[model samples]
Target chain A: MSYFSLEYIAMITGFLLIVLGIWAILTYKNLLKIVIGFSLFDTGINIIIVSIAYVKNSTAPIIDSAVSLKDAVNKIADPVPQALVLTSIVIGLGVTALMLAYVLKLYQDKKTLDIESFTDLKW
Target chain B: MLYTISTLILSLIVLVLAVIAIIHKNITVAIIAMGTVGLFTSVIFLLLAAPDVAMTEAAIGSGLTTVIFFYVLNKIKNHDA
Candidate 1:
C-alpha cells in the first residue's frame, strides 16, 4: 500500500482512536471518563467501517447528476457500510445515554464517581 | 494527492484532540475536545464521500452528544451543591 493513501490514513486513525479509547478506559478511575472512552471506541469503529467501504476514485453512492445509473456501479463507493454506520451511530448514542444514567444513579447512591468506590459486587 | 494530504492533517488533528480529551485534568475541557473530535470526524466523512453520514455525525455526535454530556455534568454539579 501507499504510504499516504486516503484509506490507510483513515483506517490508521481509527485504529489509533480505538487504542486511545482502550487506554483511557483502563486507566481512568472516573466513571464519566470511562464513558468518554466508550464513545471514542464507538467513533473509531464507525470510521473504520467507512474507510473499508471507500473505493478508489469513486464518488458517493447517490445516483444524481454526478453519478448516472449505468456507470454508478463502478463510480460510487459502497453504500452498505454507510447504512450500517448510520445505525451504529444511533446505537452508540443510546448506549452513551444509558451509561450516563447508570453513572448518575451510582453517584447518587455513593456520592462518588470513582470505579474503585463501587466494589459492592467485587470478588 | 490533495485528498491524501487533507485526510492526513484532519486525522492528526483528531488524534490530538482525542489525547487531550483523555488526558486533560478539567472534565469540561475534555468534553469540549471530544466534541471537536466528532466535528472533525464528520468533516473527514464528507471527504470520504459520505455526506449523509457526515451530517448525522455533526448533528448527533458533535451537537446532541455534547449537549447531553454537559447536561449530565450540570446535574451532577447541582447535586453537589
Candidate 2:
C-alpha cells in the first residue's frame, strides 16, 4: 500500500511519539519520568529528521566497488541527516546526563522526587 | 521491501514502549522500558541503513543514558532512607 509507504509510516510514528512525549511531560509528576519524556521527544525528532531524508529503495550512502560515481548519486540515500543524527544522539546523551546530575542535586536538597516540592533555589 | 515493513513495525513497537516509559506508575520499570525504547530506535536506524547512527544510539541512548538514570535513582532512594 502506497499509503503505508516507509517514509509515511515513519513520519506518522515520529509525530505521534513527539505528541505522546509532550503529553507525558505535562502529565507526569515525577522528575525522572519527565526526563524520560524529554528523551522520547528528542528521539522522535531524530526519527523525523532521518525519515525525511529517506529515499525509496535506495541503498545507503556508501561508495564501494559495486557503485560507480555517477550511479551512486541516484542510488544512495541522502547522507546529511545521518551525519546530523550522529551528533544529535551524542548531544542527547550529554543533555540527559546533565539533567540526571541536576536531579541528584535537587534530591540531595529536598530528598524527594516529586516536582511540586521544589521551589527554593539560592545555593 | 521486507526491511521497510519490518522497520516500520519495529518503530511502532518502540512508540509503545516510549509511551509506557513516560506514563507508567512504577519509576524503575518505566526507566527500564525507556532503555528498550532506545534499543529499538537503534534497530530502526539499522533498518534505515545508518549503521553509525544505530551504534551511537545503542551505546548512548540504550546503554549510557539508562545507566545514568539508574545511578541517580539509586542515589536518590538511598538519600531518602
What DockQ number belongs to candidate 2?
0.75
The CA lDDT at B63 in model 2 is 96
Residue A82 of model 2, lDDT score? 90
Model 2 clashing residue pairs (backbone): none
Tens digits of per-residue lDDT, candidate 1, A19-115, equal 9999999999999899999999989999999999999878888998878899998899999999999999988899999999998889999999999
Off by over 4 Å in 2: A121-123
Tens digit per residue, CA lDDT, model 2, A2-120: 76677777777878889988988898878888899899999899888888888877777888886678899888878999999999999999999999899888888887888988877
Q: What is the TM-score of each candidate against the true structure?
A: 0.98, 0.93
Supply DockQ values for each candidate: 0.82, 0.75
Backbone clash pairs in model 2 (N, Cα, C under 3 Å; residues 3+ apart or in different chains), count? 0
